[model samples]
Target: MKITYLGTSAAEGFPAIFCNCKFCNEARALGGKNIRTRSQSLINDDMLIDFPQDTYHHFLTSNIEGDRIKHLLITHSHSDHLYPEDLVLRYGAFAHNMRQERLNIVAGGNAYDMLSKTEQHGITLLKISPFETIQLGDYRVTALPARHAIGTGALIYVIEGEKNILYAHDTGFLFDEVLEFIAEKRFSFDLISLDCTNVDIPISDEGNHMGLPNIRRLVCRLNEIGAVSASTRIVINHFSHNAAPFYDSLVEAVRSDGFIVSYDTMTIEV
Candidate 1:
């Protein structure tokens, strides 16, 4: 399986829209990986994790074929994650060649409500229930509950293919149920893309996002459970502009701890 990191920034994005913070200034000057857009990811060019407002920009920058995407899995209805209005562009009148091909959009209740109100095109909406598994082509995806906004359930996807991956993000620490589920499961993941939004910020407990300490704890637990292989890859992404240690500093920090930090446009094969 091939995974592509489309964007890795939190809601406001790195270097934000406005503000003159030191990190923002540095990110602007450094450019490249330092410049992150809203969070999103593409799997094997056929499935997309989230459709952020930066969808168009992601396509332009990555030179990806948007029409070829057969599945869209939205983690939540947050503006940074689900840009439901963009789906309008895929409708009959706006887009050609999207006629016969089916586009399956998997999301939670809130996301479904948002998509349902919009005009349907060739898209099929699937309301994801916590722990319910859905098969998409060769991948079997299980959506786990994310402890985020009320009524807005974020998803942590367990994607099974040539490699198994836990696409966990947009939320803080794993829920107890999710942890127990994984503990009981025999399957191990080749990759785990986790939320590292508050990498530099210290928190008693992971709330809406994960900090370095929480991430370290999670990693240790995964390792202890043998859920991660020696070659298993762990990547941290979805950074907030408010994170004290900015891009390069954060990368160094994670690297020092022996973990990979995801950047915009970063690709990994599993």
Candidate 2:
């Protein structure tokens, strides 16, 4: 499996538009890894996780062939995550012959509604529920409940192929139901991409996000449950500019604690 980190920032993006905070200023000046867009990922050029407003920019920056994506897995309906309007571009008069295949878009209830409402073409929307496994070509994906929102029902996706990956983010602590579900499956994860929006905090007051301490606890728990092996890779992403630490500082801190801090355009092969 090849996972490419398209954008790694939270909603506002690091170095938020027109803001002049110290961190943002430093990030803007430093460029490179310090710069971040909204969160999104691509797997082996076929599967995509989240479709942020920065999708176009990501494609341009990475030189990605957008047409190569066959399946799109959405975690929720947050604008930073799912930009349905972009799907419309793949339809009718706007889209050229370059993109002709119907893209399969899989998501939970609210996300499904958002995508279904779009007057678009070349898209097959699939509404999924927690614990339901769906097969996409050579991959198997299972959606797990995310303790983020009520109407939207965020998700943590388990993607299996030659290797298994757990995409867990835009969320806080794992729900007990999710834990029970994992216990029953007994599947080991080769990679875990997690939420670390509040890297400087002990706990996140918002139910939708995770902090450094909670992430550490989650990692310890995963290790205790034998969900992660010695070779398992853990990546922290979806950062908030309000998180205090700057990009380089954040990377150093997480790296010292043995976790990879994901940056924009970072790619990993499993």
Which candidate wins on lDDT? 2
Instruction: Report the lDDT tens digits of candidate 2 across residue range 134-168.
Output: 99889999999887875577788999999999999
lDDT of 1 by residue, 1-270 (tens): 889999999999998989699989988988878899999999998889999999999999999888888888988889899888888787666778753377899988688788889877778998888899999888899998886774676677898888899998777788777888887886699999988888868765548888889988888888777788678889999988888435577777877677888888999998
* Reference-based TM-score of each model: 0.95, 0.95
lDDT score of residue 253 within candidate 1: 85
lDDT of 1 at 41: 97
- For candidate 1, which ten residues in a row score worst on lDDT? 91-100
- Candidate 1 TM-score to native: 0.95
Off by over 4 Å in 1: 244-246
Quantify all predictions' global Cα lDDT against the true fold: 0.85, 0.86
